[model samples]
Target chain A: MTTAGINIHTGKAMPLNQANVDTDQIIPKQFLTAVTKSGYGKHLFHDWRYLDQHEQVPNPDFVFNKTEHQGASVLLTRENFGCGSSREHAPWSLDDYGFKVVIGTSFADIFYGNCINNQLLPVQLTSSQMDQLFALVESDASAQITVNLQDQTVKVKDLNFGFEIAEQHKTNLLKGLDAIGQTLELDDKITAFENNLPQWQKA
Target chain B: MATTLYDKIWQAHIIDAKKTSETGEEGLIYIDRHLIHEVTTPQAFAGLDEKGRKVRCPERTFATMDHSISTRSLALDACGPTNKLQLQTLADNCKKHGIELFPVGHQKQGIVHVMGPELGLIQPGMTVVCGDSHTATHGAFGALAFGIGTSQVEHVFATQTLKQSKAKSMQVQVNGSLPIGITAKDIILAIIGKIGHAGATGYVIEYSGEAISALSMEERMTVCNMSIEAGAKAGLIAPDQTTFDYLEGREYAPKGDNWTQAVAYWNSLKSDKDATFDTVIQLNAADITPQVTWGTNPGQVIGVNQPVPSPNDFSDPIDKDSANKALKYMDLAPGQKLSELSVNNVFIGSCTNGRIEDMRAAAAIAKHGKVAPGVTAIVVPGSVSVKAQAEAEQLDKIFIEAGFEWRLPGCSMCLGMNDDILTQGDRCASTSNRNFEGRQGRGSRTHLVSPAMAAAAALAGHFADVRDYQ
Candidate 1:
């Protein structure tokens, strides 16, 4: 995944240490009322993070509220992360909450795409790799993980896990490319495709 | 190379296929239809405004206000200021963009999935997308339809194309005739139960075999609507006589010569006889029973007659953990009979089970008895047209007389975005798709079932097997 202008960054890791976390849990539906996207940061994991609806009582057991995991920008979770709902608010909330990278064994397709668009890199590693990372983070909250987009590798103490992502997705993160602008460059091709469409397609 | 039904549609719309990703072929796929709703589009519309971009193809795009609007009353001001502003934003955006909109008060307006097919806006071989997960509902028409995030919505708005690496194809073959009283909802719940929630991840499922073909177009939609519940972006059935007949005389359907030509092309849209799939799953239709989701995810389901399973029931530790958590949240113990569970509310609606056919099935059961005194039962039709059709057939009367509330059409009680919601800690037998923790309301629990099961549960004041009613 090495390319020009690719940047590598490291951050303290926080372990959610759970699987099948759906978007509803990421940012609940009640908070989806805003027309703007910025205010969802405080409400991320609204239900699990708080014992009350008003955010008055922070659940002490939740990782995000745990003192050790505070200020950690990396989120480590297990399989099927972001499994339900097509809400981009899930990624927006994660990005706003300062998570630079989400490493999981697998991700739901729509959630993966949403994360890429927002530059919240979703790195998929093997189940064993995830387990090791989770253990590292759990044992030492101050553990830092390096994400090298150019090398497509996540590095921690004595472990360098190479992960796979789509080439275009990688490029977009590195370049912060405008997808709409790039697609418009193919306007001629789009027009040609539309013109050749069958009569039933036009209606 | 032999082509699957999914491959045939994907190949037709692929603008470029030279790039390959870890999953499969990566390319730009053209979208023919883009559906928009209130909950996910305000940001997308704002992004478009920030870029000063016009919608690439307004005709192909349709807008609606369903998710957050008040379904109890259609009046614009009935929803609080927060919801009103969001609804206004969509209405303004649609007017400015010149996109056809089915606003909240429109008779044709309902859930996007329910209204899309009724107007013939979705057709075979077309690629459709929306910002909501149930967008997969359109795939029942043999279209390559999937949900997208808001950024993808803006991307589609500006380019009318999606950048995606093709998902591997899986064929779920449900052969043999369905047993009496088994419906499409039962079959899909059974499928999810067999394949865990993540079983279909990274694949586009093509449901085939005699059982799928026998389903009506509406019933096929019921099966495809929950594709996301199993982690698949889309699931499709091959278009056949039933599909064509359903679309034949609809408003947006092709007329005369175009109609004749459309059928000819659609007839050729099936998979090749020797087609290959990356994964194949076979299940006997006879084995499926009326199902209910006892756990949070759709995959954690069982037949109505069964007992709640313990975490030990799942061999995998991760699954075992999820089960323990879900059981704790659901407040049930292992070996507890599912039928003995009492429900305080019955919600029969959503994109999954809110169509006319769903209404008829539920009403058929409602006619036999009154809703239990303390149980609150409500039937929310999928669309305005579905509401009218139900009323015309006097199905609404049966529900009302049986003490079930006949409500307006919206995704009310399903996602609990609208005014209709369950009280905290209320247990509901619902016909909605997801039963995620707090989906209905904070501390509210949902038991997913078919419409008939929901109605029967209302009558019996507990989780009752629909087969017993029959």
Candidate 2:
């Protein structure tokens, strides 16, 4: 479990609406060397959100920089959001930037796992459903959406959509259980399995 | 049950099958091998220390420094203070945990994916993983390998097990023999070009067919390395005689009776004759041409003879918009021939195309000519072993004599993590994967191609057909 874990959240929805938004764009390689995961939110979408190399001036055109969508806790985008790199820092930046849920038509596998690990919900909806959410956010920048982990539902006004998440991920997110601690309980099982392994299977 | 090779391997790794667990469906799958690099493992080691947990299986774990290390030289101080800290942290962490580390200057040290296979640390019918998207490179041996985030890395360090949801199976069948000059890099780029980058988002692709079967082991590794570019966590080819041959004399491969047992097990790892896949994509090798990326993403590509694509050329609106954004970032005009444009830089290396075979292919082209004036070219081999082998064969002389810089091994100019960066507005023909905006460096425009193609471009100072040079 984490002190920063979330179960239910409702806030303004920001529409990126682009497909295949990769990790390099999410957080550029230059900022990956920090000793810890925090302090990355400022650099989230660093290349796209900044007008200059120093990142001092925010690009006014980016959705996240727009005054109306400034504290959005939900990100609504098109297909294959977070498509490259196994960088958990991508989700770390998203969580640090106050985003509780990433709504997409589809998501890259490793990126999805990272989001679950960090308690940043990755909510997958159909293409049309994603279109609807994009339309909702585009029409009213202040539009708020609610994500309920227990129900596995993402609701924007009256339009409600169901999403699928691994049962294990859901339980961990809801209970704030740390994955490593939980696995440590299986030490005996691992030992037993190792004892019966073939020669080539062991180092 | 009609089980695929993927199913067989995935099922074999299951330590526990949990049907009702809140954590995962496949339950706990044992990790047979773990490869680590400096960039992602520092946090994982710290996480272990935070929890006061030792590495559950240090013997199965391996560490290396690549991502942030200096490729300019072997000395630790050559890396800037920041990179030095990251490298030192990994070495210190590995020592504390009793894990083996191939540090800088280690004769076998190189890129994680490159060193792993060349050393025979990876094998067929195993579950391999690393905190890198290119861990799929190991899947070329028919291992069920995939990338994991640092949290998963920490979890693996603590338990040597992962709770995973099995991926759907996909078979990409490449039919007929590859035409001359069409390398595995071109085939994979062509595959991603046909199926958009997100085409296989939720599946683990098992490549099969005449074209796939015909590829060398290193070529197969090149293809599987870019599985992440296709948005799949892993892609694999079955282990055949070719795989066995590649592993026969490697440092870590089994010996004598153990080898016999291993080969027998690997043979059974293939899919049954009538097995079915969740999805199938078909491509004929004859139709594929030398591919060149016209836009930022790997999927936004065209054949060598084709013109740079306009946004209007794309049928999907998302693709159209993405094309517009890419063209603008790359500062290229649509409808213009890519071959007519000049490149200021050419880089031939990365996990995708940094092996001995890749070196030979590029060296063949470089030996015949000099690097074009005003163009800067560099050859960064994938690992120390690969570099030594290339040097032994005098391929380094060919590159250096052709005016291309002969750099040491690391992921130089691939992600631009080190000082090997592209200056602003530089256009480069790079053998590395990913052509994302600023991927090479700020304001850098990258054209992805095979090593032969990159070498040809270096000779011509422009995007030239490798077939023409050969």
Candidate 3:
């Protein structure tokens, strides 16, 4: 089935300056109890975003808890934005939490893949670009950034920055095709190869 | 032309390769084996059902119930309702797909990484993918093994192929002889400590040099298992005679003429003598000491006798901030000796260090006497077979006699998906991987150590150096 496709996104950016913000901190293990991928938005960044286990009080110190950055849809962070575990729940949490674009200097390979599969845009910018974005977002909490997937460019006011993504990944995202659906398009080729395998090697 | 070991394996597995539209790099490599576990596969199965697709080459896929299975008892019925539902879903999925499953309490049931090698399902020059990140552990046998996301898992299940891009290759060459009390765990921990947590990002590491060559298969597995902890895509050691020897008599291995041919092929899987790597890191074995993580991440570690680091010690602001947070979460002060930190629990198991050798090492320490009063020590084997072998050798008896609980095999307390978890605010010396905040249990502080060190900590009721116990 075709997944959600994104061509352009314009939204307020949330600046989380921390580097190497791992998947565990994004969505702690305790919150992974749900078998399905829904309802994770409420528990995103469970530990840092909340002051207690009951999650009733927001941690005022955390950036997301600030009222100025409320309803932000873009996440601006430092390098290795998604490190540690390969839990797809991480991206699920981010997606459910209403983040449509993640702009960072770098991302862990698996997390990047998970984000792509879930139709969340993971944009890789240079450290200087990231610093500029973080500064702009921090200075004006309501500043809106526009990310154009087709043009591979991110823009805010007069500042414009170009980025790079794998061509196939760009196509997949534009077409809203999940990897499994794309692979299924090659069913004939896959079956032919499997059928031709030597008897000893056949499963 | 010289080719790196990674090139050899990657080239061999190209069912279809095409240049990516963006980078013009080759992508779409086929997977030979797909390993599944209870925690990561349920959603994939649902996706498959939604798409009305059948599992292609089910024989090439294997499933196990490890992550969420209860390890407190041998009986599968002992698992609680939620865990039982997960286990049941996994079993049902495997049955529907015709995939072989090593369910809970099965003789072959164990941690996916541990059971793959023990059953000889992992072979040299193979491409193995798993839903779990520790799938890199299979690279010990010269396979191209790495973790994949749930979407990728569904892709592999439906087509036995993965869309991929090339990864940079790095060689970590550790030379010289290891010092006493040092093990593979210490070597990997030291490597992480030296390189920081994200040093090997976007690359696959080929561990080489004399120190790596000298390790046994189990030790090699332990080293490769933690490659992901350092942010590497995978870690591999070219199969040598030692690898062939280890696989020769195991179940699922090729036999007779097939074995002969496999040996000849495995011999050719090594990197060429003139092969060049994108990056090379050289480490001296003599420089490594027994290691223990004192912070939230695996890289926040020091030698056994080293003092906890001050945040000021870090030159990078981010690293310093991480250290400060780690210290607060771990409830420790700077400059405190790691050996002086008291532990409320000692856990000796997980895919990282839960092998027969690790068990023997812990048993050697437990044989001395009972564990120190008030220390809750438990030994959960990596697999049912490992438990059986340990019991056969009376290692379980030694642990039981020393006041350590002998439990069934699974990923117990490693990720705390099961009942075996550290209580909140409890300090634990664990032989498992990942000391991240709440990794073992919510609000629990974890100090990652070697099996011997964990056992020693159990006996001393603190982080005692294994060398002192010896």
Candidate 4:
């Protein structure tokens, strides 16, 4: 299956039922030496998948090891997702692992901001709404949830759940802007602010 | 209504409230001091070089190599591969930009946050920025201090000012006296438990009340240092006689006749009796006991005598799932007594709890007992002066006799930036913040508790309460 962005219009159903999944667990500390986020996918669950016997995949009971959930790009998690260490690598690894959208009840403040900046759609939903979505994904292995950035809604079967996106954040994500890019978007305003500063303070 | 200390300091630093043409609707505040460390400075300096910029306020910017520097190695040659490279890079950057560098073996070389206050570099009514999260430690001196990112680091280097939003003020007042065995660590852990990690977001917390006032300056610093762990912008204590005494005769502190003037100014830094805050939280000091973290996050803590709760105990499914997942990773049984759990390592160090008082507390406990045979215990002081004082007081001998490694001063095992780390699946009784899985090392299990509790655990070979040992 080709893993890419999941659009609300294209329609599919995928969900990851987990909670309080910290950044340290997402990508182990051993891989932190790598300066960039380019190759963190294979080592996503280093301890969960690997064994003492030469790094082979082990722990068949682990959640990510389940066969049916393989290659599902949309991750549906419980509340307070990404609730540890401020490592930006967590979302980087998740994005690299083909997850374009993470719908959860809530997220850590830093991680949520990070995911948004990195173009990963972190959807915050109500618990009852998330419970309904979780039930739909559990019922069908091939079921895929559709998340439309344009509509700012997540649909699991006929049940439609509305998700909020700040108008500025929505525009930035749609255009794929980081903090610098976002700042640059208001270039004229920034210039005006600089020009307005008193000449004595301009040094 | 009377304004809190946060309001007083914040209003003084605001350069502009109007929406800036370049930085948007951000308030540009003048930065009085800037601290830099090895891990976050290289990229920031590189950015400055790319812009052909000299540090705009070299006098305000000070660099130190601590995050990657090993506590074991005092000499440059003994520094490991990564640290050696980091130190060299730091030296190069500081020299190139004419910024002051606290190199290895220097008296001032310690955790950037610790050294800042000791030298009187961080003072009252000042805006301090550092590339370290624990920069808020300086807030103990009544300064408005907080951390910023590498890009912000460069911005401060070029402009000597930071663009920031004003934070709301919070007063966390703990009244009455603490229990016999409990310390400031217990107070902070209890606070983190009472208010969830994100509860203090966007607020500068001012710790007050008779209990806070009773604490020594070092004890106050410990509490303020961990304020960031609760996601607070900063934590502070009103300046008192102890604060003035500690600052007196310091290298950068006001000298001669200026000392009197400085003290008069420092006295004014305290909150007025009728000062109001955005939020006020009260806790009875006598009610708190020795606290320990049972789950991955700092907020998932309980009193040392309490049992770990089962996932089903929580009404919220989100809380339940987090508790369940934490139990799985920590290999802890639901409803199991925390005091009965065995520990393999005991670490008594970090910017959080590595002060002299913490070392003295651990030594007092370790002096009476020996570390369990299988337990690997280490006592790391916060700075060179702290280590010297420990040795002077024979505290190092006490730890060594008790089978704990009396290591040098630096941040060690406090996130495993250096060689001190727990091996895979090894559980540690840590006196640091954040018990997140693998935080001490890859696949390492961490149980966060107070220093005295860590010492008790080290002696007992399990997570036992310090009151039992006392």
- Provide the TM-score for each candidate, comma-separated: 0.98, 0.97, 0.96, 0.84
Model 4 has a DockQ score of 0.17
lDDT of 2 by residue, A158-201 (tens): 78999998778788788778888888888898898888889777
lDDT of each residue in A1-203, candidate 4, tens digit only = 11233334333344657766666667765555442345777777666666542457566776577788787887778766775555556777777877778888777645665576567888889888988887887888667677788798877668887888655557656766434433344446544554564332232
Q: List the residue pairs that clash in candidate 3.
A: A167-B22
- Predicted model with the maximum DockQ: 1
Q: What is each predicted model's overall lDDT from 0 to 1?
A: 0.90, 0.89, 0.88, 0.76
Top-TM-score candidate index? 1
List model 3 lDDT by residue over B1-470, tens digit each.
78899998888766678755553356667788888998878888888898799898898999888887777765555657767777788889999989999988789999999999999999998899998888989899999999988888888888899988888899999999888888999999999898878889999999998999999999999999999988999999999988999999898888888888778888999999999998999999999988999998889999989999999999987799889989999999999987778888999999998999999999998897779888899999999899999999999999999999998899888988777877679999999989987788778999999999999999998888788765
Q: Which stretches of candidate 2 lie over 4 Å from their true place?
A: A1-5, B19-25
lDDT tens per residue, model 4, B1-470: 67688777776666655643442334667777898877656766776676576786788788776666677778654646656676788898889888898887887777777777777787777788886667777887888887665556767777776656566789999999998999998999899888876667667899998889898878888888878777787888878788888888888777777777777777888777898888899999999999999888888889988888889888866678778888988989988998789899999988788888899999989987899989999988887778888889999999999999998777778877777878778989998877877788867889888889999999999988788766
Error of 1 at A145 (Å): 1.4
Model 1, backbone clash pairs (residues 3+ apart or across chains), number = 0
- Predict model 1's lDDT versus the native: 0.90
lDDT of 2 at B315: 89
* All candidates in order of lDDT, best leading: 1, 2, 3, 4
Model 4 residue B91 CA deviation in Å = 3.2
List the lowest-lDDT window of 10 residues for candidate 3 chain B.
B19-28
Evaluate residue B249 in candidate 3 and report its C-alpha lDDT on the 0 to 100 scale.
Answer: 82
TM-scores of chain A across candidates = 0.95, 0.95, 0.95, 0.82
